[model samples]
Target: MPRRRQAVTIRHVAADAGVSLQTVSRVINKEPNVRPEMMERVQASIAKLGYVPSIAAQRMAGSRSYLIVALNDRERTIAGWRNREGTDWVDQMLLGGMLTCAEHGYRLLVELVDTHNDHIARELLGAIAAIRPDGVILTPPHSDNPHITQLLEAQGISFARIGSVKPGAGFAVAMDDAGAARLATDHLIALGHRRIGFIAGPNEYELSGRRVDGWRAAMAAADLPTDHLLEQGDFGLASGRAATLALLDGPVSPTAIIASSDQMALATLELARERGLEVPADLSIVSFDDTPIVRFVHPSLTAVVQPIADVTAHAISLVIAEQAGQSPSTAPVIVPATMAVRASTGAPGAARPGGGEAQGYAGPPAGAGIVTEVSSDH
Candidate 1:
């Protein structure tokens, strides 16, 4: 290897521009009262020398750290990365936030904080001390936690809540979880599925409950019976497996199922196979999250896409803009979720009553579990 290239610094820019360090600092920070000619000359020197200021340098004026911190649940995030499961949300969020932050000359930092820890305030306090970030983005449980929001508010820091609809403080960014579920449930109803089972994620997540509400809303609207058709999962494989078992083995088996997470959907698929049931034939499955893996699974999953990246990017913009005195509205940003129709869902497998022609999306006969045909008003 030849000589290692030396990193360019602000000092180099000042020297190249034949100006004092204070002048260069003001120019870099865009302080008021700097003559246009002087600012232009310093900027030219900075461009020519390819001088990139470090975060430490950027914070020398003590106004901003130029970093946006996003907090996620430590346990789940670690497990997701370790297991390589359907955990595309974090990756998508980071990608969108980082890219959007770059446009504002800010950096993104992802901090994992345990949701169950009683010392959450202490943990957040440590982060504030170490990074002194200008803003924060709270995800999932943290988003709905009053403790986290209160702490950030007391610190006078701008923040955004993802997947939260709670009132007060911070920017609230969320997807229409209920609407997404209703759309999925309607799809099944339109396919002549009367007894549709819903696999809900943990209640600790507000979004999970909203999805349940959506399913119930749709079923009630269609005048369908929901008895023994609802079960709870933890957005994990085991919980999904157990929920699927309960739904299938109950008094009345569902003609179709909607799972709140991709992993749970996979478990449903596995259980269906174990029961000698073919997808779209014996049991139709609709998965939530729609992670990259869902598309590649055997008999690809029909899924609800959460638009995680877009939501995250919007959150970043709101937080940054608030810090810049833009005063973005506190009203929740409702980015709607959409469905990806795939191979995993179709008409109930059992033949329609009296052999009526199957309606909705075309697919092979689902199997022998037919339900009464009803006009779907949803």
Candidate 2:
């Protein structure tokens, strides 16, 4: 007759090790104050018996684990938001969240979602039900989405937004887009640029709107005319190039141009080159989001630098505090922008019209183009 197969159990581990069940339980659970030798013995016995703790049993015992789920909009991609090559906002966000979680003995889960559909909140709700995370972190357009916000609220799932929200929202951590835009505009105005043009980003994002609004407000406050010189782009390099061309070819061109992002600003520079126009001397230019590569270009770009790491850190802190049952901070931080000057801007010396070309500093004449150093607080 075949030998009877032995049943495997926690009791078997205790019996085989000649220890009581309570000692084995303490060892298996990693409870505090277990003797070193006793823990070793219990572990050895558990290995011998092939004893595995059942997750189901732990859940039924009224114990719950902490989890944080981060949700990002899949439709939009943020430059310098990745972890590779240069400093990325995503890595900083993860780092801050991980550090906070480790300190509080919590777990973090990341989720990327597409915002094209109308029911993203529904999908997020499903994820919440499946993972049962303590809270969720929303980024970009998703933070402004009313559907997801309502669902998360109705379900009693705590959530934090990673970008600036309208005034009166309880919890959000983000840079002041309008404030940043005002600073960028102020920089150009101080540099003697009266005919300043703005290249607007996509209208789909709230940041885009806020940035443009800030530009208008600043220009008006400075007694500058807000006229047809402004053009809109889709926040892509190509769109920026097209918009730059439009503004340049118009009857009333601006002496200086502010592209909403580094990518768009780079495109403007490229367009200036294609049109045989010069930078700074002929047409001063500035961009936002002092991304890493902006400094490495042929002519370092003048830009408004956002405090990416600080913004993300604040967001993570809020999320972790709520997860750990701590009172949330009163107001979301509105980080300031730094104005980084490089070779991309100059005093308004070039004539707008009449005396021939788009009169401004046109780099070095023709083939003798001079490369300039880029300055950024990256």
TM-score quality measure for candidate 2: 0.72
Give the alpha carbon lDDT tens digit for every residue of 1-378 in model 1.
Answer: 799899998788988999888888777655557889899999999899888877787788568888999999999999988987746889889988999998777899999999889898898999999999999999998898888899999999999999988788899998888888998898889888998999998878989988999999999999998889999999999999999999999998997999999999999999999999878767889988888888777777888888788899999999888766567788999887778777677787655445343234443344433222211122
lDDT of 2 by residue, 1-378 (tens): 999977677678889888987787666555567889988998888787787765444345434445678787664443324523344445666777777655544557778787778777677778887888767877777777777777887877777877757653437777788887787777778777888899998776678888888899889999999787789998668899989988988877887899987878999998888877767767788888777788778567878776666676677667656644578775766766676767677767655455333334322333444433222222
lDDT of 2 at 267: 91
Candidate 1 clash figure, as a count: 8
Candidate 2, lDDT over the whole model: 0.72
Q: Report the number of clashing residue pairs per model.
A: 8, 4
**Which runs in model 1 stand beyond 4 Å of their true positions?**
1-49, 350-378
Index of the highest-TM-score prediction: 1
Worst 10 residues of 2 by lDDT: 369-378
